[model samples]
Target chain A: MTAAQPATGHDHVVVAADVNGVSVTEPVPTRWTLAQFLRDRLGLTGTKVSCELQVCGACSVLVDGAPVSACTYLAADIDGRRVQTVEGLAARDQLHPLQRSFVEHFALQCGFCTPGFLMMAKALLDRNPDPTEDEVKEYLDGNICRCTGYEPIVAAVLDAAKRMRGQA
Target chain B: MVLPPFALHRPTTTAQALSLLAEDSVPYSGGTELLLAMRMGLIRPTALVDLKRIPEMQEIRTDRSRLLIGAGVSHDRLATDPLVEQHARLLAAAEREVGNARVRAQGSIGGNICFGEPRSDVATVLIALEAELGLANSAGERSVPAEEFFLGPYWTARDATELLTAISIPLPCAEGVYLKFQTVERPTVAVAAVRRPGGDYRVVVGAVGEVPVWADYPGVGEVDPVDLVGRTSPVSDLTGSERYKRHVTEVYIRRAAELLAESER
Candidate 1:
């Protein structure tokens, strides 16, 4: 499954994106962005679309194990790339530690920006298990949260780190 | 919103990608820049050849002599990779400053370099690092040094049928720093400055011109502002005027010199 045969014809592009752990291949318009493809073609709405421009970070999703905004990224460009949205953060009935911490710490108000924040925080903590306040702040700088300010989100991330380390 | 209708092709190999591109198909990677341009209707290609699946273009390997970064390696990976930090820490720092977490995840180094936008932070760092870009076409493979890579704004030496394979960066002497000044907080202005041992310096300024400008100033004897500014062509964009950019470059150069001097001391 590493190399997919190039299908004949160019009318529809075959997208072999591994969303979370699920390998999905679908025919998408050549112009469809990954965000639109996820929301419309694959019916994965967990990856939201807010700022189509690369700014707001509301459309954040993990592409190939790294957080990226899906709005401006084309589905045709992500062939064979692994993508993970907010929907893939949980396992069965148990939410990821970051997700649980967000709820426990009340990190979300309207929750419009929660997914982006969660993804960004997950990216940060995954790379640096014990991130200092400055590191966390620097890492989360791109993810804009208009609600609940930033203290609760930072607290949620810290708490999640503690729980992950068996400290909480 | 949805993308306009167009043809798509996924090329598994670089040769196939080049062939498709030779047939006038637009090669796409990561699509952070291409998609935006498509949305803006700046480019309207009938077919898009996706290069993500090409195995040769996704590797990041470093030897004792040089680091070969695949064109498709994402900014996020570059920013966090231990190897990248060890070899090109300044580049890693600049990678961290690219966009948001999302942009870094989706944006590829090849795409960034080929996009030819003068405001690119990575381009500045690559120029300062004296990176060499590897390009492959149906004909053969050729390497272009970073100093000679960019032709103009949003343009490179790459032909329509050529695919950028890799970028090779020589290992520095464990002494380098990249400092950037952004207009507000979104897009950065001046990008990176690398300081090597023995007072060797490379200063790069981005976003202030049509293409990133590199100046190698080793010591105080070679610090000529007139000669340095004359070599670079700065453009007036929404971010800053040409004069303003030049002024900032001077300020950044002086600041970088001081930082490098302190590091030496």
Candidate 2:
């Protein structure tokens, strides 16, 4: 409820980390989350953050290729680790397979949950390139999409997996 | 959103980590539990000590008869670790069942144990297997039985300066089986059963009590897990009434007992 603290260039020691293939070493506040560090400090606003309350799965990101809720993960924890956000998933202008599939299958109505879903699916497919429909559902058990019903999102993830595995 | 500003220290060695701990220095393991508490104003640490960089504290080794799980091992690693799969499959399964995928990836088994949550699935499984906890401090290292580790909700026997180093489980003589029922973030009730080749069994119930209840069954025929539920007074909070939790606890005990019997066959 108090005023938000100044995010970047704080009076703290720089912790080096790799964010989307970019090695960044900056003085981050000790209390900042990976989501806040990316969106507020690094100017990578593609990583959506929905504050600390609610397990809505809106602030999900990839830390070392693992799907983690960025609302809770400390930025200090990601020091010296690789973080792949929705921004990193795409190479330049070419969309990642999951991003493309989301658009094709109408996975998002408002697109707020798109970034989180894409990053989580990317992590899931990275570990399991060929996940079953049930496996995809299970892998995304934590991720919630209220805008577009789960079936379309699940279908999009399955389609993305197929494309990533070279089957489509 | 703003959190109270604090200094961060990354200690690569156990001795350095121990030296940094004080009344105000909070040692950060996985940050899954601590960060949430900090956000809620439950705890305010002046210094946050990061301990994951220590190599010795991150080793998961197994001997011929027992497996040692480093405190820093993530729940994801525990779910798929070869030694945990072969020696403590019940633990691996419990770890896999603890939370959703993202929580498992970020939370550490040590943080889970040290947090001492009343409805902890990991605590119940560990107590049932009779795992030993390794604690380290500036003084020295000592092993404590899991059954005695948990004192209450969010309370453990660990000293402020001591850090949980590892958890060790012996090879089960029979089978280690655990069953849980949950409709919320925390389980409704969790029961674990360990059997021996000689027919003796160890049963521990979690989430429905102050700590994991290590039960002593009076032989195989005299005491049934279902009947034992009505006899104890378990605290009832958000999950349900005391009576309802007791009912669910009985169900899991019966199912875990059934799995233990099937393991023998």
Name the docking class for model 1.
Answer: medium
* Predicted complexes: DockQ each: 0.56, 0.40
C-alpha lDDT (0 to 100) for residue A137 of candidate 1: 84
Each model's fraction of native contacts? 0.75, 0.51
Kindly report the interface RMSD of candidate 2, rounded to 1 decimal. Answer: 4.8
lDDT per residue (tens digit) for residues A40-76 in model 1? 8788887777867777777888766677777887776
CA displacement after TM-score superposition, residue B245 of candidate 2 (Å): 1.8
Chain A TM-score (model 2): 0.88
TM of chain B, each: 0.91, 0.93
Residue range B40-120, candidate 1, lDDT tens digits: 788878777877778888888887778899998888789889988888888888897887666777788999899897778
**What tens-digit string does per-residue lDDT give for candidate 2 at B107-224?**
8899999988888889988887878999988999999999899998899989889999889887653366878888776788888887654557788888888777766553433438
How high is the CA lDDT of each candidate model? 0.77, 0.80
